[model samples]
Target: MRFLSSLLLAALIVEQVLGEYGMAHFSDWGNSKGKDYCIFFNSQWARLPQDLSKATRLQTYDLTSSVLCSPSDVPEGGFPNSIPMVMRGNCTFYEKVRLAQINGAKGLLIVSKDRLTPPSGNKSQYEEIGIPVALLSYKDMLDISKTFGEKRQVAMYAPNEPVVDYNMVLIFLMAVGTVALGGYWAGSRDIKKRYMKHKRDDGAEKQDEETVDVTPIMICVFVVMCCSMLVLLYFFYDQLVYMTIATFCLASAVSLYSCLWPFVRRIPFGKCRIPENNLPYCHKRPQVRMLILSAFCIGVSVTWGVFRNEDQWAWILQDALGIAFCLYMLKTIRLPTFKACTLLLVVLFVYDVFFVFITPLLTKSGESIMVEVAAGPSDSSTHEKLPMVLKVPRLNSSPLVLCDRPFSLLGFGDILVPGLLVAYCHRFDILMQTSQIYFLACTIGYGIGLLITFVALTLMQMGQPALLYLVPCTLLTSLAVALWRKELPLFWTGSGFVPPPIIMEQINCTQTPGPSTDEPPSNPEPATSETNNQREDPTPATQEEVPHLTDASNT
Candidate 1:
């Protein structure tokens, strides 16, 4: 066990070191190096003729102007005498797009050094870019530049392409695969089974001796729910159409009725036990305390939501207290249960802090202040255009400058609250707490919170616009509450109140002794009058002696 723990520690250290290095070299999503600007074209000109109809005739001066001109000798304007353009060699298209935006460039053109393989279809086309973008061959560039001397202006067209980082996408895929493989390996190991065995009661039966008929029933339930959601969409088309459809798909794909899932285990297949007596067998102080701390973090997040920037100092104070608590916990983790808690703490701290700080430094430089001023009024008000706070890098250009970015406690609070809640639910099976009335109430609250956080965080990660993201989160939370109301009674009556029965039959049947060899003694006769007076009973007759058998062992 010690050796295994040491191995795991070593692996974690290695992983962390690699992760840090990866972050330093790549963007937040593990894309190519995120340098400031691409400045391939001037902001004054209409962006790279996305559509021929929208194209404005480029003026002689605007034809070769640049917003963020680097002192590079790269040819520009597709003309031999064209102006010098600053071209960023980011390894991913997404970074190129972002860099173009930061530099206030009118257009971006990405060229590959290797042979270009155009995407087969434009199903996932980019709807819009802050600036237009195009892909061209090196030879095409040369030919176009040679004509530039004659025409002095060339009509180049760019398509509406969704600029996604294929490399980042590949990394995401690999990480997911690695996690799945690790999970499978861990599941196949003996440790979990041994842990479950040790945790079982001394005498209990197997969990699933009888065949269950849950499949068809579950399928029917799913069908009914999906149909109901469809009806909701039909009736409340304007209000609920999108939400209803999303819910239906989620239920269909994620529910147990689905044919098979690679990552998710079958809900009813595992033999989790409900203790007959309220012994709190698996409950440990660290586990319970972790739950409490997670809940507190959520509460803080909620409080932050209610009072966005008003309680900044209070939030800071609370964080300090939390740090102190962590110090206390460091000492308390001498026991095994707290060891897992320690790991959880370390992970949460590192992941949150890393992203919070790194995002700013990795981002490209913003457009010039005068340029933003020169642009005409946008549909949004000035305040709307400005991020709640203006984040600027410190004069000291260390990685620590990321921390100097203007802080938004609310944003951090929202992310942390949900993530920690999810971890809490997973660690303790809080969803299974509906058995007792007190626990049921706790579950209802926690479940609602969990649903909200799940939807909110998922939407945040999915690139939804900031203003609209909260709606989905709120709606999901309300839906969860309604579902809990409907299921509470059933939960209380059936399996909810009864702890899952622990299986202990395996323990009793684990090992056997060698066959016995001692012979049976002669059986004594029934008690006589003297024996009765002596108050003693005769020896019970052996099974072989009593039964009409050739040879048999005694009972």
Candidate 2:
């Protein structure tokens, strides 16, 4: 159940505990004068006589590079009372640690060029080794060497990694609250649009709330694009990450504008039209308020882009933009039915599993592709993180700083994916006049799924495919509710939400076909009167049929 190695590097030594992997503090000198590093060792791999997990007093060790491999590799002087810094890949952990132990080293420090994994050895081999051995990143090695010479004295101990961070509460609030609010807005807007359909003749208003109904064909294409983009990002991250950043800036600007325009448009003062001109987008002379709002949104997006790397405040901006973007996406893209929701969530469930659990087998680094991309490649030259995720800094102090990402991340996909279903449930509830039963059920399921994801994340210590839990929880909860309510059929196909036009569309096929010529029909008066009578009949539309009429409107 061991997770991928940590992303922590930079001034601290990293140590992995025995049964569960946790961080250990690495410092130079007995007085904590130099940079912070971690002394990462697994008691399971290289057993230590004294419990290093509870280590408090500064146990200083003079570092030496004499024994870089087996005992044969020990230097001529064979310095006593020194911890030999072993180079990885020269030999096995047991041989190297045994060599160091025989050479009078107190402990062994192994420097690696790749991600840190526990030094592995069998029980018999562990019994043969008397000194503790731990893995150190090449970066930490370089920092140690540059700061203190080859023969440097350093103190090492683990301060106990917290079981959970309070930041999880903040993360939960941000995630759940966003989902709830977004779903509420989506449902309320849908109901408002329903009420406004016959009341307003403004095409612009119709266009504003219009959403792209997801089809089975579109679901396949979208998943394919997602898979391709993820792989491309994994392979070309250092270069493509900037492209992602730019895309985020642009998209987030639009999202911000979409989310804010409704409020800003009501300001009334800036309602004057831009002077009519022949410019491409300005030909119709859009409102002055829209222009100002657009500028403000763009500026905010650009500001976030420039300062995204600033861990302190950048995360706040990123979270805000990310939430707005998710809400906008939920409103813009329509799932149409529970079937579409299931299709999307299930496909992504498989996609997430393949990348996180299975891809490691195919990868050279033995690291999950999803984790690698999410955490950023360990060998990335750019050191740029993708802006697609919502970030929050870790609250508790341990070895993490909080690692490469000072903040814990929850991708927008995790929020928006299940969120789409949640929103669908809300719309369904409104359509059925069911008092939000489906909406509440699905949202609670989503919250539970998220908790399970967090619990699994802690237990596995690996980057989990959140959809693995979220999809099933949300989809099943919705399904169960539909079954209980005896509305599964209607919910599945969303027939209960269909617009009035579709019901009459059946009349077209049922009606007789007339002459296919430009000449007017001799009985055109009867046809026109029949249409008027049919339209007049629907005006007394009872409350019972309102649900079907409001199900879906012809675009």
Candidate 3:
């Protein structure tokens, strides 16, 4: 599972980097006869294009001649170029679009000099152009122009919209494959271990067994925590934001201590040992450094999260911090058993589905519970509002400085719920003396599940309960693998199970011993010669019998 976790971490980092730039593609396209046509175009901005329904399938006009050349060089009655320094006969894309808008053309298609080269233009510069414009490959332009010469109207339309990227699909597949492999490897290893243990205790069935029964306690804790979070998110959002910052700080401090403690322990005189108890205490304590650094980071994150209104970098920093905290939890927390992890997932699955899907139906306003809460102001006074959510912003630099609304949002529940299962799987692997396959499997399942949830949200354009997909993928995949390996029986029985009758038989066998000449017997036995003589003479006990009879007569 470590491999899966590492892959997911890598994928996430890639996603973060790519998400910053946003993805672009044509949202809708059609031709002049009202039949939809596919045209390949690159996105210049992350924002959605303005309404283009009326402009669709409009006649295409080529103003490349006048718009491409220098403004001073263009002859009267030719296309007017807006940019002055553009080389003669070389198109300044922005100028061409401006000229097209000025000429009242419904659509403009520019032919690229090279068929393989994508058209480049500043999105902000062309925002006010109003008309639909597209840059076509030289070959496509030629084909269209040929059709136009035949008196058939040629039309082109291009509109950029915010949509999910293809990379997400790749991420999903990678996640699934990684998780399945991990589960299979882990399940195989666990089965081998159990088989070996069974062989070792072949005749001895009364082995001491320890069962872990923390399921109820875990469920209760989960329920309480979830309820508290929901309450805070819905009613006391501002306070929740503050709490989130403080929690991040505390988590950071602990993480710092953990990282530095090992090195601190290695230094001479760094740790002090008591003479009486021989208990070692750290002299070069990390607490002070942890406190100072944590405080500094907390102050910066909070100040940025609260005071820096609409600051993209501030939000990005918060997202980074949140991710770091989640990763730490994933690394530290341990789940007692695979069964417990499955139970937790199943419960959260129902919980997630209800809050995301059913709550909207129940509400009078007909809004998703998560969405409403996420978008709602943290405070009654909007001016003092703080965002409780962790968001990563999409930034655009070309043509203008614009920050697209945060494209990625991560909820605390999303991290903590699956994290518990992953942590549990990690501990299970360690307990079984196996590799980290189980943890990798669980982590991969989580990544794949999250990807599915994101895909659903993108396709449906609505909020989705993540655990609806996550729980089944993570729990069922690993469970099925275990079952296939025939490990389920032993695992379900809490590591090792022995029937009571078999246990009792083994106990009796161990307690009772076979005949041994070297040890004294409970009853005395005569020597071999005496035993033979008694067998030969049927009245061997005559002397003892006469004595007994004489004694009785005397009495």
Judged by TM-score, which candidate is best?
2
Candidates ranked, most accurate by lDDT first: 2, 3, 1
Better of 2 and 3 by TM-score: 2
The CA lDDT of each predicted structure is: 0.28, 0.69, 0.45
User: Best lDDT goes to which candidate?
Assistant: 2
For model 2, residues 1-555, the per-residue Cα lDDT tens digits are 000000000000101111223333445444445555654576754443233445443333433444356546777656466666656775577777777677677777777776565676666776777666787777877776677643346444544557778877788889898889888888777767766644432322332646667789978877776777678778888887787777777777877888998788568687777776999777767777878988899999999998887877888888888888878877877787788899888988888788777988898756666767765665677777677676778788765452343566777778888998888889888777789999999999999999998888778765778888989999999999999988899888775644467765766434534566567567866877776676677654433454542245532
> Across residues 19-110, which tens digit of lDDT does each residue of candidate 3 receive?
11211122212323322233333344112233344332322334445444444643455433221111112555567556545644444455
Error of 2 at 32 (Å): 8.7
Greater lDDT among 2 and 3 belongs to 2
Question: How many angstroms is residue 405 displaced in model 1 relative to the true structure, after the best TM-score fit?
Answer: 28
Decide which is better by lDDT, 1 or 2.
Answer: 2
Which order, best to worst by TM-score?
A: 2, 3, 1
Which pairs of residues collide in candidate 3?
1-436, 1-437, 1-439, 1-440, 335-424
lDDT of 1 by residue, 1-555 (tens): 222222112111111100000001111222222221111222222234454345432211122223233323223433222221223243344454444544444444444333222211121224334444444334444444453442233233333322332322432233223222222222222123323433322343232111111223333443344334323422343454233223322222222111122222223343344334545433322233323334454454444333433433544433332222222212111111212222333343343343333433443422211112112111112211111111111233233222212221122122222222222222222223432332223234433443443344333332111212222332343235426656433222221212332422232222222236265323323323434433343233122122211111221
